[model samples]
Target chain A: MYFGPPGNTLVIVVSPPPDRPGLPARRVTIADIARAAGVSIAVVSYAVNGRPGVSAATRERVLRIAEEYRWQPSAAARSMHTGPRAVGLVVSTAAGGVSSASSFLDLVTAIQDVFGKHGYALLLKVVESVDAAVATYRTWWAERRFDVMIVTDVLSQDPRVEALRALRAPAVVVGAPAAAQGLTSVHLDDAEAFGRVASYLIGLGHRDVAVVTGQPELHRTQVRVAALARMLKDAGGSLLRMTTDAGPEEAAAATRQLLTSPVPPSVIVYDSDQMALAALDVARRLGVEVPWDLSILAASDSALCRLSTPALTALPSPLRELGTAVGDAVLAVLNGQSATSHVVPVGGLAIRGSTGPLARRTKQ
Target chain B: MYFGPPGNTLVIVVSPPPDRPGLPARRVTIADIARAAGVSIAVVSYAVNGRPGVSAATRERVLRIAEEYRWQPSAAARSMHTGPRAVGLVVSTAAGGVSSASSFLDLVTAIQDVFGKHGYALLLKVVESVDAAVATYRTWWAERRFDVMIVTDVLSQDPRVEALRALRAPAVVVGAPAAAQGLTSVHLDDAEAFGRVASYLIGLGHRDVAVVTGQPELHRTQVRVAALARMLKDAGGSLLRMTTDAGPEEAAAATRQLLTSPVPPSVIVYDSDQMALAALDVARRLGVEVPWDLSILAASDSALCRLSTPALTALPSPLRELGTAVGDAVLAVLNGQSATSHVVPVGGLAIRGSTGPLARRTKQ
Candidate 1:
């Protein structure tokens, strides 16, 4: 196979013919890649063949360029990626509480639908902490555990972005990391969604509202809290906030504390359906009628929302669509495409039985 | 490595002394396995070294024998097992709907807790159908996709048990597959628990009872149905049963159908807390007072049980403990030990507001 940069033109013998019949048509040629990437044929040949004459950065750019043009490596080159046909979803234990959240399940199903068709099995890992999650990613990369990974619960200033990029790992971040830093990302617009939900509540004559958020450190929670604060400020409503581990007991205890205060808020907003349900339980226990004495709203949509007594009003997320977008990003990254970002928009608030105007009407 | 058998003595020169220091202690010799298996040293050596003369069946038997006695392979041999550090949990799409069930979340946490500590990521797959699930297992085995797998929603005649067993895949069944057929299993006793719950309800002076089950095709459902039938017969009461997809809409419709019947059940047993909550909603909408006009029981336990307006009575499955047992079983299987089973016992029922003494004093 002869490859060279002749003057300003890159020259190459596209396929060195000792084809021994019909074994090379499926393979993308170096000349084809070089033309697509607009680089010298020689550089494309080196990148394709795993020769280190070119810089790693240049090689990566060339590979992404090749993938962008939908190039398929030949039998010889495909061998380099012939380990297990698996992708992974790695989560932190802190995010485990959301496992029962219906949106997560819907997203998981959607992701499996796309990846399964492409023959990539989903490997899910829930690590004890963010550090453990990072370590797991590094170990998996070193051991070639998966062809690609989907990182959930991304942090505001994610260290994983640079860490994974340094290794050129193929991964898609769910819930946009604050500083994406070249990592492929697929996430919902949490700030916009939270503002929208808050506005809906504020429009309902709710003031002196209490926001029950999940853990303070979670990137999504912090983002939502900030968005809520801004929206509430605009509506001239003051806010009381409580942060919890998002467990049933903790959420209930927090709800209890909020309701039993000297001057309790009339409306309570929750980060999870479970927390809102806990609030509902608190209402029943304390003789506070839902939507009458206290109105409730869920920041996240879930089956729990619909099943509750006065089904919760929630910000409906198009989770399945987001999952498909994540799947696409993951597949693109796995195919060596340049990292990209996607913003999956949320649906408008689902108005259920849990929310109403604060005006009291006399019983007929 | 020469190995020989004499009468009762199996002599094995397990490692040809390339100690280079303190490495031998970490490596178990072929002789150590031969004596433990009570087999000839030559067979042990053949099994350990992957010699072609030994049969595949014989090799598997020898490997299990080696693991039985705690034979740790050396770094040289361990390299063969150095691929993905991952496990998998394969569930059906029908079961995927149950992802919101608090019990499922608990099990997921437990599985991650166990597997994460040992560095095995959980690969979760929700397939389109039973056939797809089987295909996934076969493909995973062909591609060596996982180090271990936990098969949930085991069926009456589970094809996966035999198929995976044929490949000698390391898997632990969440519920006992009717035909375990050499596969490792860990399950809760569905029938016994159902009988106990039935007895409790019968003791509460209920005669006309309704038992709502999840997908009736599931083995656990069949077992529980059979048990409930027996217990109800023993108590001289007939049952009004309904099997739905266990969704909120379907469950609510079913509850409405049962409640509005000419002879409505005095007590209702639900397969899940969500269904029971839906039943609760139906009761409220119909103006039937709980505990006075009807009683409810949730066969599956979850936080939903506690958070409902009238908290549900439920059977608690210690999911974390079960997960630990599964992890231990997976570790055991990966270590090539003889296949084993563990029965995770359920705790006494969590009695709550949803259930109460049937009012024969008023209704009759």
Candidate 2:
């Protein structure tokens, strides 16, 4: 049995189980009893505690199922009555991605600061993959280690969201709105931000634009690609997109390929400050003058962007604000407020020496 | 009362407290009772739990004091008996410091990987100052949130070490050997790394060397400065040192100042990869061609150092190995081993395009 939002709840009914006189092989969870009883977990809870909610027959059936299964509330379940006063965040990325994730650290610091003031500690875990992250969340949730969880790097079909939903854990996703999948989220207006970037580049007379971005599967990457492609097509220009693992080597290789192509892009944008910096290095190595023969821009800004040679043009990520918003969303969920999504506004583009007007071809 | 290593212990004596018949004003901790009873925390634990290690009279005295103070073991303390199976790490730095700390993130990822395999999660906190870090540790320790703590960015006179000792918490300091201050630590040989840098610069026929480093009060900074000064003095060369808050702007300003100086050094070394990259930008802006008119090196290496224009010469920080060593030290301490320090060997300098032979002056 499953529980949905209040007033619009959906419950699945299961066939009655056969009577088994033998003891169970392992400790049975409330979820297990709920499944066997063909009722929602809340109904099982009400039945076991003798609360006045379900009908007498239904309550008896739930209680009998629980007894047959030898179900006992876990220490974690019992402790939930007294909150743990902590939040869990798992960053599922490769080891290389960790070092290049300066904005991520900034977001963490902001979230920690807000949560700390509210007497909640952030329990952080960094894993290699989303599947590992889901496993971690399960262990943490089963232990009742935290009152809420903050989910990041939301994919198109994230398993973490489903896992959290199954456990009915309070959670807030931090990613694009479309990727939240009905879960509460604090996200950036990626479509609007990408549209602004496209307008800015096109307004600067760039016709052939190229974007070197992270994995194509990431929701944000897909959103940005679609937005840029739409705007470029409307303007009768072509958009070329290349994907990398968000590593400097991969970004550099992509940049090299783009630069050596038959019809090289006049303006190239990168998904991260590190990737943009890598593109800069590749351009310098190839003797291509930045903002002259080629223009470069970064999707995210950092100290690296500000201090790099020629100073990269970038769209500054409002990580601190986004973190605070996520913290607020977590607090609201913990406070029993209905889950709602928030969109934090992003700042405008920071124009620097790396980007310039597309110059006319001398030979043509 | 105090406890040292198992064999050679020092216990302080305190006068008996006045009898209090009323309930306490606030919840009393075991430490308070231990202080009034003039016994170590271990003795208090044994007395409270009816263990046989302490004398009957001492146990009676301890119990009487505990009762008078209305002392009850904290939930955290009770949970400690069952083991929380988690480790704590606090990165106390300013907000800007968090973004520039890529190597710190690398170290965290490596540590997390090791601890995760051991079924231990890392509880991380980033604060603005060491005092705040100490306060955070106190809160975490009082709650018994983690079984062990990993202390980073150790100062010359660190209060955290003393605080951890007072709490009797298992901990491992990650910094210079001198900074550990009798605590268990995993350290890199800063003196040897600085000596190598000094030798390398002098070998390149550079008579004047400049070092741009973090706050002078930092233990690692002082160690590097002293070692570099000693090496330069022995070689009949002069050394110039400047300190910054480890921000890119300050580093760039220092670089600009060094380049415009009447007798600017031929080789300038930066304490971090970010600072070196900032200096590279500054040198370019000032028309000081890298490795031709000026040479640059970084004390720590990262992908930034490798991909920067001219490719900064650096000493690769073995952060992964150091993190693993720290993890091992943490496990050893948790397993009741005596506090013993471990020194991880540093790798040799990675000479890149930034450093070269000092060119003869054309107009000097």
Candidate 3:
């Protein structure tokens, strides 16, 4: 019930017997296991690893003694390559805020599942900037921390990719290959999906549309925004744009500002499901009926979109599928096979109630 | 443009001139830097690290060559306690769910700010389970991956605390200390804030209330649920509890289910700002006007809570303050001080338009 003032520091001295004591019992090694089992270190190693060449009786006996002692193979002794393999993911909020994207979370979750099933654990590092992300990746590799690394939100000519590739650190990138240089893009196309949404909106007689997305510095966002704009223009329509940090509040504020503007668009598109829903909240507050008065689109779809009032029309980014591909790409790299780019199909549009014809609008 | 079929494994065959070719120009080590500078590796180390015993001229000359040839200090060469110091955070969505808690994200973000100013960077590992989290904590320690570890969402009599203590792994737990045994909790009370909200609603003459939160399995959730139930009972009112994953869709569904019930709660309390907003969205769709028809309270305050149609009344869980305490606790542990639990002050009510007297509901 006691809380600290700004400068106060408290300490609890719980004197309990330590779980691991410094009192020396002679240290046991593989050599000791070999000596005790009356076998060579090679035989002990073979038995311990379940590799062939050790007799069943000797294997069982060696395993039993190892279990009794609770011996652990030292990392240095396992020598970098032979140690337990893990996949490392270096995520950053810096270099244009990839953290704001739900796809980023979905990708990591999917990677964890696929990697976990393969007996590979994850070493996740969420750093502040791209520089810190790269530094962590380099330091982790130099330290022999994990077997392979995963990099997300790649930049055009990313230094992280260059550094990781220069180190030949087994790596998979979750972005476009054009920006990634030679590093395989463990990426799927959300661009094509945006194009489809653009055409869908144009077809519905929306002449003026706006795309609200995350940081402009991000390669994926830039690419998607440009592609969508171009497609919208080609369809005899014009697309306006807004950028945000992708937080719900930012999105909500942008929605309110845009809606109140002198020349507001009839249709609006959002980069995230959360943001699109925020737009809905803004609309409802202002008495703007969705679809009937203002059509809306969300780039990424989730259960939130489907269940929201008016059920937002959305272009599914297939984040889990992209993540699975990313996992595969990481495995492929770790397996030392040809590191090939995995182009994932962008998810199709789910035409819910949020989008409608320009003729339906009864602007107050 | 060609993405993979579900079963297809595509290959890029990029094989660009490898960034780092096997054609070795003799690898440079500390000895090479020393030889080039006409000094010992010790002198080179002193120069590189800005340690004493090396002349300024020699230090400059040694650094120039080391930079020229990119001679680096290997992890083994740096040795234990001599390498860089970093703080470790192992966040787990394991033991049911912790991801739904906005407080958890706030804590990490806060920790990052406090630690970064002190020249410490976070090495975060988000794992799938408590067992994996504990293993990661131990491994990160043994490998000297970080100087200290951070454990969140402490359980009642948590094994992670015992394991960390046994391994002498420096750590700070984010939740209360009961489950941590003696590890210390860098947490504040939300119970008080919830109590005030209950009183506020009771003052409005609300009889029926519902508490909707995520993951009843979490110890924090259990305590909050119990406390809220007790407060509601004391007000001569019964409380209904609903468990969810705290996803917007799930919350919306729960809202619909509760509203259509035989005796719907006059006031609904949501665990997250997002969920409360979702509940609002559901209300909007169901023609159930908020405050007049049903009142709402958000457990955590964020921008999303403030921007809704009828902005939610919320209990502010000052995430940054709790996070700062967590950072200080980790720092204290790393500094080799006795583990101290710092309680954070609970936040006051941010009364918005979401709540109104039950008699006011009769108007609609």
Candidate 4:
């Protein structure tokens, strides 16, 4: 190949044929013409690509230069003309390296199942701290790696929601959009879950009750606690205790303190089924009989909860369903369609041997 | 821009263009050169790209074409010339969307932590059925989306190991790779965990013992059961009863049946801290006294286990550390470095008040 100043450009004899016999391939690109014409690159782009702003004479000149070079972009380049096909999912988990709730895990599976069916593969990146979560959103937006992002375990006034808005990026939150204003959100009716459990305990004739929950700072926990308090007040009874655990150990310690209190409630309610089991152990250690001396209720029930001694009275909450619903809402928002805040109803209360009419009190 | 037969090649004229700029736009691509080169596109690609076999003169001609067009692929494409930077983790859970063990969850978090620190993001995809798991792996491979893959909760003679081999993708598994043949793997010393628990119980003067575990098919469970069998045999007493729970309900039901048997074991060793609580509950319901009729041993201790009634006896297992170690191994393997299979030692047995010397029997 040979090149020189424009009009007198010389074409030299090339060597060595491709190994493949009888196959002639032709793929050209605009860059070739720009070099041949000694013109600015964008002028070449405007001339051959037919994009606007270049004069017809200039466009014609650029095409003539490109023709002399016989340049074309490869098939791969032609395909690039189409829109980006890959969809991106930015999975944000709560900080502290905590695994998401069981229900959220299930929901993730369901959402993945649905997305996979639609030929979209989910891409996950764990967002450790709130700051890191914000950074991830910013990075993903600037790079445009994903078509949509799903933020999960949203907090009241999640900073990420604002980050997404600032970038004008599409996002769906998997918890109440407490501070997200117009962002799409999905979550379970925690108040209802709380009200049901409180009502069930009251129906069983338990006036004194205790509630143990996870981190009080979690929005859902606050909602449930408030609901429990309101229900107890309306029922002409008062909650004996409300404690929270950052994790299982804290839950167990709370159980011990609550159970051994001078005036322990006859029944205990746990925010998570796992914590409820801890409470059961505390009761057993104290020689307190379940359903006989102390009844137990689980706001969130699972196989583990149901199988606890005396079979706990529980709220039938489906976590997997909630996760999938959030995922669906995210997809809708990303697709430029407005989606309503999704509220998955918790299942009705599950009554088991864990609850019995208050043991008849004997006159002292 | 204009194009014609070889000699009447394309030309691009930059009119009022070189100095005019707003935000200095990116360059155009080879496709623009093709349109200018006039010959059925391939001619331009054949000429300017100089990809060989284009006659010398034709190659020179194509170069002239590109020079006229002035196009180039995006900088993003240039950076991607090496490959994608992320790794994919396909977490396989048990049937019914159940997550892997808590230890595994910790490991995942740890792995993510380490990987993120090293400038690589971990991509998590949860697969339920084994078939779906394999399919997801194949899809990811076909797309070349991940640099390396991590498969967890390895089954006995898992098909994924073999499938991964066929794919020849770099991967680090979280179980014994011996069965996996050529694939690299990291394994936990299950036998050690069980041995520690068994020895703890034997030291407590308990000859009769029961074990509760998860699905028997799990490789770790089998290892624990085998270790328990061998150790118990040495003590002149073999395992009295060993049961598995597909979930918590089955575990509780099994515990109920075990305790209600004609002769219940004096001590129960639980596979998980969660299951141990269930065993404790069974003892309480049967009116059995701890340390007197029942001594409980929690095999895997978490913070939750320590806070259980009697502050349960448990094996000090560090899941987060193991997870981080595995994650490092994955990154190493992906980076073309050799990673040895590491077996992190389990922490020593933490004996709490849950177990005590066996009750002395008086002659009738």
Candidate 5:
């Protein structure tokens, strides 16, 4: 199949019109329905679309004609007017390598569910860098190939937000208030989630707490770290240690060291469930009994956390709800309406085997 | 941003051109370049594309003219006549729930990497089901949105093969030898990989071994499972147990039961890294020391396996090379060439902290 100029009319020339008594039929077209209904092409289009000017009787008549002809309107034709019924999720990196993180993998899966339910195809664009992400969005806009764009891993003062503003494109940012307010935003109440985790540990009579996180530059990580600090201060307890690793390997290395330290904290919390899994490994490696000598908590939930030996205590992020909110915002933005930013709080801290009472903090 | 027939182009008619200096500029046209080169628009096209019938000197002159005018040929315009420089990747299902069981996510990411390097944008489509996959492919073919198509998740007597053959569409299959010779295929030495792993275990004096796998319906899983059974028989030993689970949850549950059995196997092999993680969780819960009471081997390499406690032994799938092979095959089929079926062998096994010699099987 070759793509050429728009001048080419797609005319399917059948061979001799199938000169048999019961031959297979050809493709049904809008013109066939129009002719059968004794209506003009414009009238048929209006009736099919349920435009106000079309009378109810005429609309029913056109529908009856279309059913008789077994005609289906082309998806392309419909999309041309309605924009592509697809959400463009331009992830800002390739799938492999150390720098890339799968923290958003669950979110991607959830978003696909919401979009698919709404008949919107999810298009993945692997933008090698931030600049590439902006360029892909521009290209998508020019080609009219996406109805909405969902942004993740939002950096402070992201260029994509600026680009979207310039193009007046429909977009939803899974990010913080300042950068996300102009567009629509959806995220967990991260500050509250972290505060609760810290408070839970304090309630268990633990004074020494160490926190491990993903990339320190991430916006969500910053919020979580600050919340932990605040919670400790309010409880008249000081943070024993706070560490930020560059990647998964570094996170694992730090976790091993923290557990093996002579003065290891009684409780350890991570910015992600994946990181929390690393802590479990470190504890087992050092022969330090989890909950017996150390406790682990993370900011998000997944199957990994659920299936862990001590089903991890985590703040359950509402993945499906976040995805649906993004979808709703996209539709609103695309219709030239203001989509107000929303914070979908992931309430309730789930306690699992990973946590236990202070365990005589003297284990340190 | 609002859709709906574009609203008559929204032409905000400006009064002539604003009398301002350096008001940026509009995109240069083919006509301007043609005029500058003292040639026709057809000549410019021929020179830009290096087509025959254009003298070298004339081509150079036209290029110089185009450079002076900054006349970039539009991608949409260039796509005409040339096949679409994009491939449609129809993932059989969205990355949610049960679909993640098959290695579709990995395959898609790998294939995208290969295609992206070649300047081909992948038009991703998530088919709701197997039948939907076929329908989506048919529509994509009819619409001419892609130059080549990739077919994965090969099933017995697959209908996709027949559909592609009927359309004579250039395609590649990521599976076993199918009945149709018209399509190119790329498969891993799954049986060989499994055989190597089994032989390694047997050499380590592990007599009692068990295999846990993902969905058995997939052709690749079937191959690996069969290979394990055969290799054990050749070693004068038998597979102590064989089981299939739906996903990580079921795999974790299965692992718990298997490890708790009175006559537990000395070693366990998993079909995927995720499942291997589940096995690890189960072993930890049952207090069965890894590489001690039980050794673990994962079929696929991922961060989970590498970072887990007692780093898992696994075979890297040679993802980059596999991607490259798929890319090359797609290009070959598109060029009307009969590409040979390519089977890339898996890389050597990466033995880590997981596998070890079996404890002497003394009377218990």
Candidate 6:
């Protein structure tokens, strides 16, 4: 496969068709080209607009017929052939919502670095919901404003996948393969990461474990929950699950509720490093000694985890590598490759001062 | 001041001039219109492209002459008139660099929310340096890819401002007015905020103070340092300044160096909450008691500051309000209005557990 040299100019050549006697009376439309090429209008559109889905031969035939018929594209369609290269990424969240996960920004930076090297700008739109994101994508697609799209936070049975499929837009999803619904995806092995967590906790002779995770609806959250639950059960241990909005206060509230419960677990695991830090604050306030009366673990690691009072034992997700993988997938899709999924490796659990043997939990 | 209704469609009308005897022998170009209108090619180009820096009357005249000559715009110029409305924001930072200040993401979200309401998309590009950022802006300007640009992290003598001015690109700087170099700016009252910090610390009976700040070249950092240093001198107290790359390790190292020095200040202030948190970790390892043996403060506030072991006292910059102000400035520039700077209100210092009266300190 040829990866063209990075540059500002984009060259798409369309040779003139066999000589015709005269120009048509009326202007040639996409419908005329579709009929002449013996293909559906969508196929003609995909070919004419330089979008993915149609084969190279089909695109060439459609273009030749379009040239022969003297078809003129609207300004919006014309811009697609002349505009600066760009990729659209619509983030569905409330204002300031993205700040909660610095990892999101890291991922964006990584992706931008890759696309920038390939001479493509990232067009970002922050909307309020998945429906709005889908609508934004539809509008951008209709305008032919960008060459490709990057879809993140893929949901179970996401509508975006189907929407992009129908539009024949080239896109890459940054989530699990199952959630991607056959689209190209770059994701971490959440199940494998969580399995390592369970083994480490079970090795500490802890039979009872509790998990504090973000929104339960997230496919990532579900995957980790399933993996940890399965592993704990296999070890003859029990698992308790609690969910938060991924905010520090919510995480603290969940931690408080767990510690005061009639039967609190021997260890508590948090989905994010920030959430785990909040739990540490809550534990300190409740006069619970870490790794002595209780244990704490963060599923995601960051500088915060390394510097916290009792440095948190965490499963480090390779966010930069994951981002690079996502960027590569985007480039592949844009280059007309078939949809493929990539699973980047996750690092081993970093054992710190946060976790200890269940025998130390005398109060429990 | 007509603030057009928010929508995707952009209409630029150029009506045909009074009947000309006959069409020109050759295609008319911007140069032909410029010659006919008795203006420089730049002026005519600006007028024809609907960009700023051209008077309304001159633009009208240029448009009429161009229509009279039957001049047609290139594909790029035509796209400027019909493409979806967008604003560009190029962040000059290394990959994963933006993750350090979650506040940056908050600002982006806030800005995106306002622009989204106005039917504009935010096109983001993250580059490695200011020079690259300016080059990106120049390319985008030539392509007419965006309606306005949002500039951030203004330096004492920024080349970006000069470049944008030369291109006559409508832009808004998110920094001090002095640093904006005649461009519209949205900024916090850094002097006022720093003055408040100075007074609060001095009122607590602290004599000597040390500040751990990010890159000193940043306009924001310079303003803060000058304000704090001047105020400290006026109050008969000495000030020590330390700079960092805004990384947690650097902040920690700075804190350790200060603590192990021959003479440590009674109080320490940090440029960011993350740095302040790192300082707390350093203080803990050094056996220095916060608010007792030493006082700590953060210039920017966040949930981490509120939830730290010894909750940090911080000056909360109204990032959301600042972002809204920036959005408004961008819209004003797009609507053919003159450039103007805006200063959003900053909240007063929030006194928390980390700071206390200097009388409580005895180690010195």
**Lowest-scoring 10 consecutive residues by lDDT in candidate 4 chain B?**
B20-29
Q: What DockQ does each candidate score versus the true complex, computed on alpha carbons?
A: 0.12, 0.11, 0.22, 0.15, 0.21, 0.14
DockQ: which candidate is best?
3
Candidate 6 whole-model C-alpha lDDT, 0 to 1? 0.78
- Cα lDDT tens digits for candidate 2, B1-364: 3342333132333332343323232234566666666678889989888988877777777787776654655433444346656789887774234534666666777777777777677787878888888898876754556778888877788898877765567889887667776778998888898999889888988879999988776777888889998999999999999988887788999999998988899988898887888899888888899989999999888776888789999987898899888878888887879788988878889999999998945436
* Native-to-model Cα distance after best TM-score fit, residue A326 in candidate 2, in Å: 0.9
lDDT of 4 by residue, B63-141 (tens): 7655444343332342244444567777666632253444544565677777767555555667767777788776665
* CAPRI-style grade of the A/B interface in model 6: incorrect
- The weakest ten consecutive residues by lDDT in model 4 chain A span A20-29
| Model 2 C-alpha lDDT versus the unseen true structure | 0.77
lDDT value, residue B265 of candidate 3: 89
Task: Kindly list the per-residue Cα lDDT of model 3 for residues B253-309, writing each as its tens digit.
Answer: 899999989888899999887788889878888888888899988887777677777
lDDT of 3 at A92: 74
Look at candidate 6 and give me any clashing residue pairs.
Answer: none
Error of 5 at A330 (Å): 2.2
Ranking by DockQ: 3, 5, 4, 6, 1, 2
C-alpha RMSD values across all candidates? 15.4, 20.7, 11.3, 13.0, 8.3, 16.0
Tens digits of per-residue lDDT for model 1 on A226-249?
888888888888888898878676
**lDDT tens readout by residue for model 5, B140-221:** 6554556787876666566777777655567788776643345788888888888898889999988778887765556777
**Cα error, candidate 4, residue A72 (Å):** 25
lDDT of 2 by residue, A211-279 (tens): 998877676778888999999999988899998888777889999999998889999989888889889
CAPRI quality of model 3: incorrect
> Deviation in angstroms for B14 in model 4?
24
Which lDDT value does model 3 have at B214? Answer: 79
lDDT of residue A309 for candidate 5: 82
